[model samples]
Target chain A: MASPLTATPRVTSVTGASQTIPAAAGIGLRAEHYHALLQTRPAIGWLEVHSENYFGEGSLPLTWLERLREHYPLSLHGVGLSLGSVDPLDLEHLRQLKQLIERVQPALVSEHAAWCSVDGRHLHDLLPLPYTEEALNHLVNRIQQAQDFLGRPLLIENLSSYVQYTHSTMPEWEFMPELARRSGCRLLLDINNVYVSAVNHHFDARQYLAAIPAALVDEVHLAGHTRRVIDGVPFLIDTHDQRVSDEVWALYRFAMPRLASVPVLIEWDAALPALEVLLSEAEHAQSIMESDHAVTA
Target chain B: MLSLPELQRQFASAIVDAHAAAQHESLWHDTLLNPGRLTAYRNNFRINIEDALAAIYPVVRRLVGDEFFAAMTRIYAGHAPSRSGNIHHFGAHLPEFLRGFAPTRPLPYLPDVARLELAYHQAFHAGAGAPLSDVQQQRIAAGGYADLMFTMQPALRLLRSDYPALRIWLANRADSDEVPTIDLNAGGDRLLIYRHLDEVEITRLDEPHYRLLALLAAGHRVGTLLNAVSGPSAISRVIQFGLQRQLFSELMIIENTP
Candidate 1:
């Protein structure tokens, strides 16, 4: 695992952006209005989809996705690689994912930094891991194995956690950059998750971002979250039903300059609205990305 | 207190049997916060699976009202938590779950409806293949057609039930407006679900057509399929139906069969 840390990771050459979002802003690929999206081909930087959604052999989703692929640049954002689990990585899942990448040639591929299943029983939710050296070593080995299998770098995104381990020595932001540095992987800096987790666990989001080794960061995720005020103590739920909150946008504002030109995807997974709504959201991010670049310059 | 693996082992226990409370002493929380947090995880688990079920069984959702469907889904999800992460592959046991469900037994027809939906779902995602063209068909010659075991399309699925499930399903689809109460005794359907070019099409075949497709799907060619079907009229009907659907496309004619 430590050997991979000293090596430069293999990366999928971008092969020139046909119509891709310039590490600027994009929206999640969803089924709510597939027709509307294809007809208009809205002006967004890029579109991402959950890799698992396309695992079906030839459903309407596959058919539409194949059609939609021609109109836009696609990103394969994964939720279920179980990259941090102690259990062995699922090969068949990786094979299907590799098959998808071969077919789609997506511009970017990402998965969560969390684990889901253990011993083959999937909790199905992105569960937190205690950031022990034991855990880090386990995770580093898994990430390297995955990168070797896929033949490219995987951008590992930090998950929004409601529970924190008492034994965790490192914050995810610190751990994430270290993982990328150690495993020869890239970091998918999910700004929303940073805010959501920071609020839930009472940490400084900015400092977390500051601790990140900027060079290893490859992508950014901006998504909406729901606030659960269960007992006057606020816990932000990383629910994709609403708009990107102003607070998260501010955090994105702070984090954007650091990640200057990485492709940013607006991820709305549940309660997905009209494609126009997502397009509008993407435009909002694009405007911000451009505006932030202007101010920095 | 259980170690990390021990914690996970017990956690799996808590999910499946609810008897894994042996680690309850290790749990540290003020109130229902522990159970509430646990419930949130439980809800997340159930909801992820429920979402998969709903995606596959939208026709079932239409048969039972959405509200009723939600309730039944909760019950179904409680007993059958997903075993895999690609939720698309989840919910394979739903047909059997519906069959064994006591509450749904009153609506005995519901189980078959679930079966049809499952078949449709499976067919849609099965796989894509190029249909065999007339030019490709010429290579078979007429002689070996009997011994040639044909291959069905990857998206093809054969499902039968003792209920008017096709009509029930067709009526409940988003395109249709009429809400017809299903008559259980109007009785049974054998559905041929295949991804016909564009959308997944549900074709209701008669007993004979069903038997013929069943035999053919199971790897018998035209002549062997005819022998499996009882009557001449049925054989012609199935052949005619197969032609209409372009079912012979991608037909793998295997020679020297065991």
Candidate 2:
């Protein structure tokens, strides 16, 4: 028998042609809201989804994604590329990602500037990487390799680190821009992650934004974080569970000028509220970007 | 000047083994803060893995209750670490883990139920194959029934258990409020787990029908299937049901070789 993969005549392109994402706020698409979003066809600017969620084949997830692709432009935000790992890149993961990109033709594809696996065992959390010349060189090579395989430049988002590296030769803010410049990749500039990591480590969030070259930034992320008070010092964890906190929103406002008109996504992964809640957050972010544009215009 | 590999290996070790943190403290900025801060990572790892397991094995969780399931998942997560970055691929080992898990020894049926759930999960994600073309169907219809070979759909799965796992699964769903009174003496179950379009279904099958699909699942030719079956009606019924439910994705007429 012929292979199942070739059993059907495949549609090579997305139904509605892939379009460039507008410089407005979009909500992170989660499984819980799939039906509601598809049914209502809400007035969100665009949608972002974790690339790994649709890694599997032949399911409601893929089915809904196919239908939703027609209605909204998509951004494939990956959490598991593990760009900083020492192990040889996962070619299988890359192959699946390539397949997804072909099917969806997303406007932008992104992965974190962190590693999650080592020696073939996947830790599943975005683990922090020490900032060093060697680490930077390894990451730059990996990003280039991934870009070569995918035939598209990826937007590498900075990680929300819980702790800082002692042996690091430079700060994360400096490390990210250098990595992006060397790798020929763009920056995702997750503003919430900047706030979370800044509070976790004693650093100014503004300095982190200052180091990123504005032209290289293609996207911005806004999400909620949780405050864990350990030893009376509040450590912010990028939980993505609650509403976009007031402090993170403030940081986003600061980032708006630097990011210019980059696409922003409001990501809420856990305890997802009604679709209206996410839409409202996206609207709020869009208003901020518009106001910034108004000032610049 | 630790290499990138060394740092990742050490960091992964630290996440799994709390004792390994001190040895790797130099890798972090503050050795004093590393232990507590790193504990948060450990918690994240556990939550992510546990949540993946829970998503796949909701019925198993319901059957064993939440607290027991949580404790089981903690041990399972540490012992059987995920091998893939995709969370959906994380809990493939849960069925085997439950087979050896001592605390759940009293619930001997839990392992098979987990196996059933895994089958359902696999079916849910299994790739879709094109149904046999009209010309191919016509050829199969004209060809000798005993001479043809068939291929099951990629989304097809057959599972047999010594417990009423299907019933137990149905009773434990979120929509089910009344506690189902299950009789352990109800004997074994043969389940046909297959995906129709996007929805996955688990159906209990009779022994003969189950045997037929099981044989077809193993790539046995239709002639061999007829030989193993007791009656022609059984063969016809299996084929009809298989086609109706989309059990087989393709049919082939084997060629004679010199």
Candidate 3:
């Protein structure tokens, strides 16, 4: 039987063509930095926001988003889709997302490869998925349904996990690309997540990056992680509160050669710093991307 | 081997229920997983929801200090696990939760404060709509005012509380350095919370105006509201106030009865 992802042709919007984000570097547009971002209009490639933040009918966030959209391309990154849940999908959530897509017409729309809810209860944290065929099949179906509903393709990002399921048959690196292939979705590979999960689960970060086919990757996310000792065991937490660590920067450098021309985003959600700090981070990523482009060219 | 659903069910249980973690320890890939690692996921779950609640109800957190607020939210989460994926919608039941909570009994006004905060939060995110146009205003001026039905803006939230919740909220603002001592006996407040342009505005409404606006917000026709309230002039003044504040998004002229 043909997979729905492959069988169904990609749907384009009837209203108009959506803007495409440049294959450069961008930063997450947070509420704290709205005024600074609007006034400065920093030379970043694009801005990404949590889709749920603007899901309200009308608000300051939506108003600011519209203003920012005029200055830069936008990407709607969703955290609440719970794409891997066993329960039926939240059509209302999907409908709101579609409405946002129409209003903002963001260049790229993305959601996590993990689920945040099960049994109709939302944990609101991106929980890890077991790397098994059954889990893989479920995620693919949900992603296809979401893609069809939005009338656009989605970029599924890898999540940082603290626990590896005993029943998982494959590694996350393999699972991610397979998900993209089967679901007809693109990958928003988060380098920090790869590093965090690799350290937590005892896998080589390079191996995780090596397994991803470059063509499947549409964007990259680099964020900070904190090291904490829990019950005498140390783990890397994807906190996104501080600067991109040296180790993650090294991993991005390693991944950039293969991910040439892929847009990269510097995400800082908690304890957001001044807008200048995020803009500087994006500049650093842009330099790395440009250097890689020079080498490949 | 557990199926995907079974693993998720157990995993969610372990994260939410502290006792369930030990039972689900065997579900992890033992070679790499440890008790501490599983606890990390559990901690993340709690912290994420708590942070969301804290964001939505900062004044509540300020009123009861961080430690108390944290404890309160932990219990609240267990009582009402978030039903929506959007964390913003997670704390809607908090006002009701605060009312029943034992620790907050002494602070009798806490729940009302929470209600005001919730209204402000809702007003901040509610949909925008154009207020009644010049033509509609002209129609109202031409008389037959008692037959008009007004539709409240999506952004408008009318809150009436026995406690001075608005003053309590104002005194506890993060930007306000000096916390003023508020008199608990100062009397209740009837507030009009709505988004004006990009900012959320909260105005204290007088009793007569509050009663009339409250009626209109409840979808009561102007004729019924006039019968309920004293004098046509008071109703007219409140309607004019509502129009000035952009409280009514639309207006409909119903049949005039003798």
Candidate 4:
């Protein structure tokens, strides 16, 4: 692994004025909204897509994304990189991601801070990592390797989890900031994830937010989750299938001061609504950021 | 203290079988509630694969009811676990799995249907192809036929099955208004599936035509391709059809001495 002391080179060859995403709200681009987004070109700050969706050879998704790039600054949020996995890094996956990054020239790139595959088998769902020194060391090394491979700083997001490791020696909030500091990467603080995991594991969400160093957070994510009552105990499932819930929105409101003007994304993966709904949700987030920014100013 | 790889291995096993999770339950906080959380993860994994399968194989889902399809996918997931992080690449082995699966054995044609769906899925994502330019077409027209080779579009997929798979596929299309009653003993299928614009177009081909196209795709020269046809008129007709459809992307003339 490259030494964390060495400065990781930033992505060069970045061309044009829209190369950087504005400090405003964007929506996760789903296949359902591709055509509508192209024809209508909704008013959102930017658009974010799951990088794996376009991993294949040229298709409708790639064609539309190239056209969409002209209108909106894009962010590549990866779900399959499995940066926290103990398994050997899938070099082919990294190569394709790099190719895409070069092709699209997205303003920002990010992945989950959780592992989703093991031993050549991918579970296809984000799984929580034990918050131990060993796991932290492993993740820091992997992040450094990934950053070196991509030639850009990767923004790692906090995942929503249902279970916590009993053997954990540190809290996740502490582990994350430390990881960012050591790896020379940044954080994509997912506010909805914090809320969901808090409800599931009985942690204080406010405290979790307070612990993270503000400067490390480069982006924020807000998504809806499903709540199920199991044996009279409520468990929140981070299923991005609905609108941002009242509680998650409130958490976003609270974290606004810490996050300041970071690029916020509203994600609705499953049970996708109409394009207008996503646009309006993003508009709502933009309003919040505007109001907060105005107050700060 | 479980190592990171050891924990991940155990976690993966626990996802499929709760019994395996029991041994590693101590690794998680709230052992009593860990099993429930594992179940959620398992459901998400199953749902992700099933959804990917459903997207690629919609006609199969239509032929077999949703409940039956879901059950089959659950079992199939266990047999061929996904190796790629992208779910779109998950169901490549579904056609082979259908061939060996016991419950679906009664429907011998099911495997071909699955293959057709896979082909459609592939063609949908295949790279865009450009038709040959007029100058290139003129070069082919000026052909010294023996040394000329033809290349087909990357989006082309040829499939042959002893069952009427294409008919079944067309009849089962979601927007297909009239359910054509196809005879079980109707005939076998020699199919040419290719993407045109954004949609996949499927057409039937006669034995000789299919063989000729297959040979061309396999890098046979035009002289050899012509020998497969019975006569000059027939070869001319085939060549005309090929040119009209823009079937071949490039035509090259090789030197005889080489």
Candidate 5:
């Protein structure tokens, strides 16, 4: 949550297009935690950051992000906007985002399935969408619009939902693959969310993974979650604050092998720890990916 | 637009008005044990803004303890619902919020502190302009100095607060340990927030200096800006004093080519 701001984030990577994306595990780079990351330069596949974090003009955040971007392939993840809303997209947000994409030249860009605004009023949370055909078509068109505007493809992530829409004729796993196949966008499969959704909605996580087209998946997310029980029924929330749980880790191990070598990220959004903690998590995923790659190679 | 407005309103109502039933009940389980999924969204809203406030006003949060600051956030957020999807733009009005906040009114310096925080946030995201180095100054002819215009960096934030907000901000930085108590009767601050080489710097300024620089920044000519200063010494002092801080990296003269 520390400032990961950019000074002139109109462009990201000069070599982003030339370099091929490697399938490996990385950590979400944070601003408060930058000095430690640089001091140690821990072993990990790469590092990812929120695109909006580095929107400053010549601030320390931008300098540090540029330093890190040089050593690692960067992923630009967006957290703003109510993307699922029926309103027209915020042009200013898109302009800023397009500017950041040019500045960072990130290897990958991703946003959540949930919307964060309505009209001009921002709810500031990733609100869920029902998995109805109407919602699916709406998302497909939105994805196409976003891609056409940005002049590139994007990886759309599935939101972790506590409520299942009765109007939904399908699970997000089903809706998502169709979205990718139709819209030409890719999927950022968050393993933890799959685990959370499986438990909350009573489905098999592997089955959901199986439902996704292998080629459609461009990235994988492994994050921690918290569970609270109400009336003896436990509901898990995707609070990216802790280490990846063993159950979710197992789910990742199951899901990762299917996707083979997709880039995996370790996301810890709350109560963000020191750089070493996040780096270690990143290294753990890196080791898994390395081991998998070794066996495949 | 209507759909987003209605959805946002319904989402807002569901979170802010506990008595209102969720319009999208189909999304929840049909059982009696829904046990408030709205709290998740509510907490998410509060937490995100609280984080934004922390980003903007860490000094304020540190000064008022976490618990009191959180209570303050609830009051501040309730009155100032965010209007932008970009969370960075969420807390722009916190200074006004603190000025009217009943509990925080006791901390006479709180509103100014909030102003400093907002200024820092503004400075961070402000546009990136080409640095006006002295080399660029060579392009301007001496005769055209009066008529030559200058463009200030977008990250610059000019302010006058009723407290030593700059010193307070420096003393209360996340890395600093010096705790300074501020007296309510103490005089205010005139400060400028500008970024040089990616580091946001908050420099204190005098009245004439503040007025002259702000005027010039607002695109008035050197003659007008000088005239606006109260005294004759104001012009020279403003230029000399401001030069010591290095506000301009470049200055190009206007050449009317007919």
Candidate 6:
């Protein structure tokens, strides 16, 4: 099926303003930095927020989002859609998301490629999906349904998994591109998740990066993870509490050329540092994107 | 190979139910997957729900301390698994859960404190309903003052506790560093919690005023509400106070035909 959003122009031209998310680094807008962001108006390219945070009818978060939306091209990244869940789709959640999209008019919308609920019970964490044809078909149909209901395309992100299902038929990199191809959705590639899962599942990170088709990717995510050796087995937990590690940065550098012109986001949810710290992290990503641009150009 | 639905059911069980996790561990033994790795998902489920509860009920946490609060939340999670995908909707039952909890019997006021925090959370996120406009006020004052019915704001939440919940909440708030001793037997409290501009404000209400507003909120006619509250001046005073605080989002006048 053709995507309804395919005909619409990607970059919206407003009165002397571009509504497109620029191919530059942006930061996840957290409540801790709301006031500072408004006061400083840092030279970042754009801002992204978890769509669920502002799902309330009328609250301070929505108010702040409105005020901030005027200055920055915003992206609504949903964490609780549970799109990959086997249960029937949640129409109420879709309704709330559509309302928020109409309110914010975000430049991009996205949800994870993992499920967080089963049998009406929500775990509220991005749980992994098996890389099998059945799972792929299920995810594609769900994403298509969501995109149809949302009246736009969604950027489905990859999950950082610790356990790989033995029933899986293919690798994640293959499954992801195929899902996007079949569902008519774009990919929000998280380089950190790629690196984390690569190590956890014992695959070559570069091979995973190489498998993805560059044209399908719309955004890249950079976040922090912690390394732990549990019961003599090394594990990389996607903590997002600290700085993006040097190893993940190296992986990002490797993936940058393929992800040319895609907007990058620095996500820090827990133990969030000051606005300056996030700005610096964004600056680092901005610098990498620029240096990669120079090489590609 | 298990189907997607069966796998998800087993995985969800492993994360939320400890007994199911042990039973499901053997199913993955044939694969290269280590069953112990499921611990990450288990830990995340606990931490995510606990963090959400802690964010909504900071004062409750402060009153009970970190260790006790963690234990309580674990039990709470088992009893009330989250129904909504949105984590904010997870802990609505904490107040009622605390009422029957055995460990918290000594602190009788804790449940009410939980209720206050929940009210604050609800009010903070409640819809922004427009307050009574000048035209509406004028219409109310023109005639039929007794037959007027007031509609409370969506952000308005009324809570009454047998113990001094307001004092306990004020003392345990994050802004105040000093933990002031609050006498539980001093007096009970009838409190009004509502959103004003961007801040959620809590106000103490006297008996007559609380009764008047409570009745109005319950859709009682102004004349009947006045009859319910004692004292001649108290009715007008309560109405004036409610209007000044923007508690009523709208007002309707009922015509009495004989």
Q: Scoring each candidate complex against the real one, what DockQ results?
A: 0.32, 0.52, 0.39, 0.35, 0.35, 0.39
Query: Across residues A1-297, which tens digit of lDDT does each residue of candidate 3 receive?
Result: 111111223233232323888999999989998899778777789889999999986676887788788788889999999999998999999999998898878989999998888899998989888889999999999999999998889999999988776668898989999999899999999999999988887889988888999999999999999997755656799999999998888888887678868999999999989888998899999889877542211
Question: TM-scores for chain B, in order?
Answer: 0.80, 0.91, 0.94, 0.90, 0.80, 0.94
lDDT of 2 at A167: 74
Cα error, candidate 1, residue A183 (Å): 0.9
True contacts kept of 4: 0.48
TM-scores of the candidates in the order shown: 0.89, 0.94, 0.94, 0.92, 0.88, 0.94
What's the residue-level lDDT of A198 in candidate 2?
90
Q: Candidate 6 i-RMS (Å)?
A: 12.1
| Candidate that would win on DockQ | 2
Quote the RMSD, in angstroms, for model 4: 6.3
Model 5, A186-294: lDDT tens per residue?
A: 9999989999978887888888887888789989999999998966878898899999998876766665566667888899978898877887787777767655632
By the TM-score metric, which is better: model 1 or model 5? Answer: 1
Candidate 1, residue B127: Cα displacement in angstroms equals: 2.2
Angstrom error at residue A261, model 2? 1.5
Write model 3 residue lDDT over B1-258, tens digit each, in one string: 777787778778888988887765554545234544677788888798889998889999998999999888889999889999999999999999988999999999999999999998888888656667777777777876777888788888989998989888988899987667888899999998987877888998889888888888887878887778887998888887877877877777666354
- Off by more than 4 A, model 3: A1-18, A229-234, A293-297, B24-32, B256-258
RMSD over all Cα atoms, model 2? 2.6
lDDT tens digits by residue: candidate 1, A211-263: 88778877888889988788777867888888889887777667666666777
